[model samples]
Target: MSYVSRNKFESARKHIQEESGNLDVLGPENRSWWRQKSKNKQFNQSNSSMTVETVKQLTKVFCDDEALINKKLPKELILRIFSYLDVVSLCRCAQVSKAWNVLALDGSNWQRIDLFDFQKDVEGPIIENISRRCGGFLRQLSLRGCQSIADGSMKTLAALCPNVEDLNLNGCKKITDSTCQALAKHCVKIQKLNLDSCAAITDLSLKALSDGCPQLTHINISWCGNVTENGVEALARGCPKLKSFISKGCRQITSKAVVCLARFCEGLEVVNLLGCNNLRDEAVQVLAEKCNKLHYLCLSGCSQLTDTSLISLAQQCPYLSTLEVAGCSQFTDAGFQALARSCRYLEKMDLDECVLITDATLIHLAMGCPRIEYLTLSHCELITDEGIRHLSMSPCAAENLTVLELDNCPLITDASLEHLTSCHNLQRVELYDCQLITRVGIRRLRSHLTNIKVHAYFAPVTPPPSAGGSRQRYCRCCIIL
Candidate 1:
């Protein structure tokens, strides 16, 4: 307190030196300017100020315990070292001395903090304390999975940490629209926000964010079922600079929302509408038409999406690299043919359960997208040895293809494996439920690509039920050949 005046500092030094052998901390080089710093304290150190006598009294207890090398360092150097410590360690260091308390709690040392590891221990009181201490110096704060945080905690945080740009409150179940309203009211610098699984937040929260945080580039409201078109439209119009919008499992989101977003946020680069089953071809078409820079798009489980969506993306979004259309069974080889001709940068494609695709799809991709690496065709029952032959012979398969999944493609046989033996870059292949795939075929493929892992499964034929008896059935066989 009060810069630990020379007289008291010396007295404490003598008192401490009798019990322990040193008064060398707070080195002499810092003595001259230390007095003038009494008037130059950072932010308001009202709560942290302590009387010189208080520090002197504590020195007796602390000196006998252990010396802290950090305490011997200059305040500037001490704070620089504290910057790398996590939140818990900082709290403990603050208890060592009044000088150390000031160094440990310096706002600059609390710029970015992730409290997910201490979720159960984090609560409203602790958050408010951090908000007061961190203030404008805090740029990012992640309170994800800290479910016990109270409804008012985030409101307090938004008010105090006004300059925070990245805030993640995912799975903080108790927070509602009020928290977002507070954020909209105060935190204008917010750029990336994740409110995923914050179930109580509805259209009101989105509207609040839209009206205020115009700089937002990334927003995720996944599983927030109550969000719909009205909220998204406002968000799109207000934050035209937005680049990523993830609303997976938001069942209420439909074509109206996607169209509104696509129309306004033309700069969007990544859009995930996964499991939003109400989304249709028109919405995806609009998105592909507007967001030409689109790199990753996931429409998995949007069953209403047909070939029109894929064709639209192929014709417009030439930058497309990753696309997931799992469970959208309407997609056929015609859509993929167009995709291959346009999106040459395509790398990962997931067509799980898109059963209408056959050998033609693989041929189109193999001949066009030389960068294709991960291709999933689970349940694409029409894929046969002919498709594998075309794929294995392609430069993409030889140079870039890493993983290929053909599970439940019953038409694929040992011949398909034989065709794939030449894909030297291949890493793993899945053949579960491919009833005609034999172990010998896998061995042959692995002989060429020695490090490749072939995941295969086989089921024994079910014998006739034993008369008047129930017996344990043989376990299914799963092997990585």
Candidate 2:
């Protein structure tokens, strides 16, 4: 018998013997009965041992069968598995015991290598080795947060991953239009691209991207300061199938370019223009009219947007699930009420820094958007304890709420949070910068909640200790408090 089967048999026999009682009978009839019982026990032991041995043999046979099946798996299955694994995990899999290593390093699995945060000095040699091994199979490459990657390394990647599609060079500060031009020439299959926070990228690079990749679906050029309205208009005209676009912090993009994009990209689902100070209500009105299928809209820091614009959005895009108007000082309670009434399916809503919103708006939101799972009212000066109490007391409070951010809403005190102990499903709660909440309230919450995570900023004043003689202060940003 195999080792596993032998071990199982021994264990089973030991357990059976332990459970059976040691008995002694004096009569002759009793002796015959004991002999019969001994025979039955021996028969059961033999049968069980054989069964275990058979099962062990079958398991080994099945594992071998699975290995054969893996060898014959289609290319699509390999790519799907590759997509599930990060770059580091993929590389490690390529070094896992011989057979698995070969399967992981196969050409089909090397098509998309997302080396996010690939450190320069340490990761360069590894990437070079990977490029040498599977250069021809590489297609989509993302090197986001690689501060050490320079023009030379990018050129090498472009040369190696020739059929590259969907390249994200976000935070690659050293990259310039020259690198873009090189990619345009060599990596013609590029589709989705993210140049966000690339300070050196200009309209020249965007132009190259437009000319090279005609099948682009998503693009994020946020914080790329040099991109103008002209480049944006050109992109709108070039990439018709674009579904998601984020140009937040690009000060040069104007209403004209935005209108053109809204008209051209009928399939657009998500559009973020946050921190685009130049974009006014007119631009938003145009977007609301044209992009009816918009589900996610971020107009945070668009200080110019007002209730009129939000009303237009509610009327036009009824499917909007996420709306962020942070730092838009002009938005009042009426605008939020309109949103709560219209967008009943809203999952996330951020009204941070909108000082005009009060408890009345929060009550309206609690009553209207019962499906809301995430709500943020950070720095909204007028929100008070009553508003938060209303939210915690709502019917949807106990089941769906996962994240709640009430940072900087000063009027919210311990009484408000005490009412939130019923929110059993709450996963994250941010109470940063709230001055009124004390350690006493936190202790009470901790006693009830075992799994909930609380992030609160402690107040400067020390409160009096309880009868127990000492008080425990929950520090600010203390998770799982």
Candidate 3:
């Protein structure tokens, strides 16, 4: 160990000796062994706490002392810190004092600005101030959830953040195709962009993005109702490096878009099409064939998809780990069986509202996907005590399993809760809307699984009769663990 590590080890040993409390039990040999062990552990944790303490001290010294606060901070450090601070915090810091205001408003420090929830009426002032403060150093900008950000505001931002790489205008209700045109003209280096939930954006905006941001890797246009397969095809043609794409709730996109993505963007790892109600088994087949590197896939609310798509996914994508087919009501026992058999390395699976699934599927899942850690079966009406019992008795039951959600599964009872007590590593369990689960079951779980977080929503408990025979005493409990 170096000198610094050795000193840290000595300090840790002293701390352990002071805190051990049973000094009388330490024999010469035992004491020597513990001292050596403590030294090793302390060396591993060397200077981490000290570094944190130093940063805290520096922040306090800089923020408190008037003389130092007036002195200009290193331009590089100011820009670095400003990039991390959100727009609200940046604006607040500018009001600290005259010197800080100047530093905060400096052109070099305004690299990435996030005006997410800035005032609606002050859009003009906000844009003017930002443009004046950040001459050309602005690179990344996000105006997510900003209701006041119109086409003009977007144009100003695009003009200012010239070298912009990432742009997010998610839920910017006022922005239209014109905004995209301005962005294409100004921000040529845009890579990761999110126009999610922007209803006004159409194929025109997508065309601009494809034409301008050729190096784009990640794009999220989820809930943009006007974007269709044409837009997606255009994107696939222009941006070959696109890896992560989320078009969830985009009902206009069809299997054609999926095929285009598979044929063009071979490097995709994350794709979320949740609530794309039009997608069918053919889309999944295309994805499985082309996007073999995919790790995360969300087909939630794709009601048209059946077991065929899931079976194809399991057979084709060997690296598949996280799968969310929530609200895919057509999935049956056969789908789960195929998933269990082929996708053995599955880590997280959400089968919420898959009513056809039962104990047999759960048993197969437990036996096959031994590495499964997170499972959600919310609203799975077919899931009963048998399924819960089988899951609780699986090899993954004792350990590894950390999160489990069984909300609205009425068949789950106190017995299932008792079975879960053996899962010592279980961190979070949601039993919301499981009417059969009572306080007794919760108390029993707490007894064995001391560290586990448990959530139980009780709605069936009867109210006690009032003494005055006027009103009944109601008791509702929602425990979050």
Candidate 4:
């Protein structure tokens, strides 16, 4: 026996003797309870003395049994604890033990599985396993950025998970129309479907969605090259509850499709037709007259659209908050003035590359849309310091404005930076390639505007010519100038 164990046993015996005043009862039968319970099978008559080794073994056995009881958690307790963990945490918990693995992969905990965190690691086999575990019970599933998964995984989900409502398959490049067909055939309750950047999806998939998924309210088929006017028109005709439709790069869609959408989907609040060049003012006019609930609109790169569309939209869509006309070069200040006059709820406005807008547009916007929080005027060379002065003086600019982007505006000078010093809510300022703006002005602005980050792009300086006329140029410098 060790010295510590011997001393502990002797001290315990002495303390018991002093406190109880009953040394006669501390015999073999009373000292060793396990031996008494076992009918004296563990002891021998030749060695009845209480040895230190015997004390250590009995103490260890009792402690081990008590710890085992404390370590085991009740099934009800583990279930309640697992309810708070997300899908990723539950998946990680499955590695702890067989009991934990059974509870983590239970159907109740997997009703809404968001695979966004483990998208890179989740392939067909992993999805198949999830489908089998959560069959007929899963409601919402987000497989966003799961590029490694293909049609087989989706097919299994469609076959088993019938109650799926919100499914985000964003950037899943290998998915074809077959997966769409399966979803349309079974998942009738699907409300939100994101097929964004699903390159293989064609008009046939949209047709299937129209025929099967009529409950879809938010659908994003942006950059789906094969989706044309016919598919979008069919979808609008079928899905009357559609509120948000994003088809940014569908070049085949024309003004006719927009008119169909305005006529059918009257509850539409958000529409992004960026790069849909075939859409003209006539289509937008129809939308403004019909879609009264429109709140977000983006017509960037729609070169054919004129000021008439903005005027009509502002007059009709009273709840308009976010508007982007970035590549619409034809729109002048007259159209903007009309928009600013009516859309007082405008929160975010983007007028990138609109060269016609000058100080008058900014003044009108500042006076009319006081709630403007994000403003982008990149490459609008006509805007000068006078425009920024009007914006900084506006009531909302000091409290609401968070992001201000003035990239490549050559006419803007240090005076513009001085005006922005008063905008306390401004968080990000982008001043790329404005040659007139000096670093001293920007530093002064930063001192006044706390928690503000400035992003400026400076031109590269050419090194002095060598004696033989060999010109050397430094790498392009990007800093406040």
Candidate 5:
């Protein structure tokens, strides 16, 4: 009686009485219960007269009242059913009825809320309400790109949902170390954290995380300039389970922190140190030697890295599938050949602007890595049609190759297009600024491979050399170089 609300009871009774011949089917016990309800009073006294009507009423109480039966299902089962619905669907469900409203907004259903799509609509008060409603049940929450959230909202979340494990505040620039401190003091169960482009963060925030969130596994502190080697070293020492660390553009991170990470976090699989200009071959060598599980590495713009680091990776890191050494001009064919010989599982390779790689590197990759799918050789001046021909004839080109980018390889000509025709698996091809490739070549290539997307922009036509244009030609040459 107490489990079913008054409104629900009245609604069920009205429906049953209307369907079952105007309460004629209702037993005396139900009749008396209805009479008490209709009189706007509670019936504490019981009538113990055994009759057929009384038996029917008891049967109805145990088996009928469809609404009550539905509501009587286990709350845990209901919560499990609601878990598949997203936040927007849950909001729509809350408008169904009073009972549904309560069930829809239950903290258990709102545990993992992702407001990334609705970031603009989520203000501080909205976050506060959600935090209050969810309380300790909230585990994973993403407020990524929600720039409206400030320190107070984060503090409220820290106070209310301290059990939260995965929190993504990426691009929330207003948050500072204070928010991190609050989260550290309260959310001890914190695990995966993404603070990408959060400019206000510093080593203080990382220190707090080191002290509190020892359970931290994955963290992205990219573009946080104030975070130095000290913070990274602290995390390396504290969080042993840390696997993936992305700190692109964090200029303060150097060999010291990277070496510490390699020593402590041997299970690290993905490490992106893009634009960490201070990192050199020594740190990378240590990483390749210790972190055998490393699968993805991005050292783009780490200019200090020499062929020694690549050689170390070639010898040690066999599981590497994706590598980005875009601006590493110091990388040569010697290092690349070693890498191609060892890392046979290489799927994506970005050697953009590694100007020294020539036919040797391409031959090594084409013959070794048949699983190679995506390859970017932009600005590699040394690559010619011969290297491309070798790659096009390789097993990778016939079956697995999908995306091929050759943005500024000036030595490539119409002959490369002829070779690419054999690559049936080619899906997207970029040939911007290849001076000798004409529209006719691309047209022929497209006709041969109808499924492939060929992107070949013609270079600006230069007029016949005149006295006044000789300097212009020199300048154009300079630009291409």
Candidate 6:
């Protein structure tokens, strides 16, 4: 839409011709533009009557857009611009023009892609197309929840994207051990792998990855029921540089697998063993003792674990910031007291259904842990208003406290909410099933902490009166009940 002054029209045309290297298009050889006829006859009569000053108006300049762009901007700069676009936008850009298609489909523009949003649309054909286009330049790819992608498509991806380092195939149910074998053989640079909820993944898959992908640092096999201690042990023995091993709901995990991880993977930082029901106190203790640098640990649903497991973690894993021991009924106030005294940097903990914990556990946490940000004591019925009083006035409650859940703790009353009003930073509080928590108390709390969210339910104060034509119902208030 740019134009040149009539005086400089010839100069502009010459400049564009030289810069774009198409002299025959706009140079002196092209007399067609001057001889062009006006479709309206009145325009010619107006031009005859116009003065020289009027004829000095701007001249419209036209040039080949793709050629001008190719000459103006560097190819690397164009590719760099395309790199910021997501998969869908990049595909749309491919349809714009020929030059744009070449730039959008360049392998260098697609290093990392997450197709989780289009899980249903992403089938084997779509994966094959992406694999061929992004070949070798693809580094991180997540086809998580794309259940239609089977072993064949995955094999093609592995063969094409040999340098892919991080791959997430979580919830891809159609892929089996053959997909793992293909990836292990071709994509040797893979460091992080997530096979969560891929129920077909078995020992053969783990064995294949162990044999070829030695640089693996993080692996999540959560809900992979076919994976057992044998597979875990094989993976642990091969990947000595492992940092995080998340295998939640892999119930076949036993002492042998835990010991193997402790003995080989010293760099283990995050270990999420949720629902690994068979893990005993001794195995967890060994892991805690060896992997002292553990940052996040989830022992939820490990019903066999006792205070011994907590004590071992308290003594060894000082860096433990997140601990989820929900449903571990054997963990008591004594174990938590030990943990509170040692793990002062504790930020988030989920102790749901640990019914044995009493007011003393909160007292110990309030006195010891100053960095506590999130705490869930749901279904821990023994905790009372006094426990909340200690928590609300603690150092953590000053600014660090954001979320607190005391659901189903029947002993917590309005006094608990009154105490929590002092926690100005508290963002969310859950009080479901605490019958003593009245709506008046919640309103008063909101009056102080204007942004706080209190999740609770309260029944009506009284049932509605029966309707009759001869009667009128009235509610009792301050003077009557």
Task: Please list the C-alpha lDDT of all candidates, in the order they appear.
Answer: 0.87, 0.77, 0.80, 0.86, 0.88, 0.87
Root-mean-square deviation of Cα positions for candidate 5 versus the true structure, in angstroms: 11.0
What is candidate 3's CA lDDT for residue 466? Answer: 62
How would you encode candidate 5's per-residue C-alpha lDDT over 317-389 as one tens digit per residue? 9999999999999999999989988999999999999988899999999988989999999999999999999
The order of the candidates by TM-score, greatest first, is 6, 4, 5, 1, 3, 2
* lDDT of model 1, residue 357: 92
**Residue runs of model 4 more than 4 Å from their true location after superposition:** 1-77, 467-481
Q: Write model 4 residue lDDT over 385-479, tens digit each, in one string.
A: 99999999998797899999999999999999999998999999999999998899889989998689999977888866667954445534633
lDDT of 2: 0.77
lDDT of 2 by residue, 1-82 (tens): 3333434644654564455332211234434643564455443454433445345433432243343334455646755776
Candidate 5, which segments miss by more than 4 Å at Cα? Answer: 1-78, 459-481
The TM-score between candidate 3 and the true structure equals 0.76
TM-score of each: 0.81, 0.73, 0.76, 0.83, 0.81, 0.85
List clash counts for every candidate, in order.
Answer: 0, 2, 0, 0, 0, 0
Stretches off by above 4 angstroms in model 3 are 1-102, 117-122, 460-481
TM-score of 2: 0.73
lDDT, candidate 6, 1-481, per-residue tens: 2333443545655676687556344333234543342233432543233334223321212323344355567878878989999999998978766777889999988899999999967889899989999999999999998989999999999999999999999989998999999999999999999999999999999899899999999999999999999998999888899999999999999978998998899999999999999999889989998999998999999999999999999999998999999999999999999999999989999999999999999999999999999999999999999999999989999979999999999998999999999998999999998888989999999999999999998776786776757554564573386
Q: What is the lDDT of residue 301 in candidate 3?
A: 91
Clashing residue pairs found in predicted model 1: none
- Could you tell me how far off, in angstroms, the CA of residue 120 lies in candidate 3 after the best superposition? 4.9
Error in Å for residue 348 of model 5 = 0.7
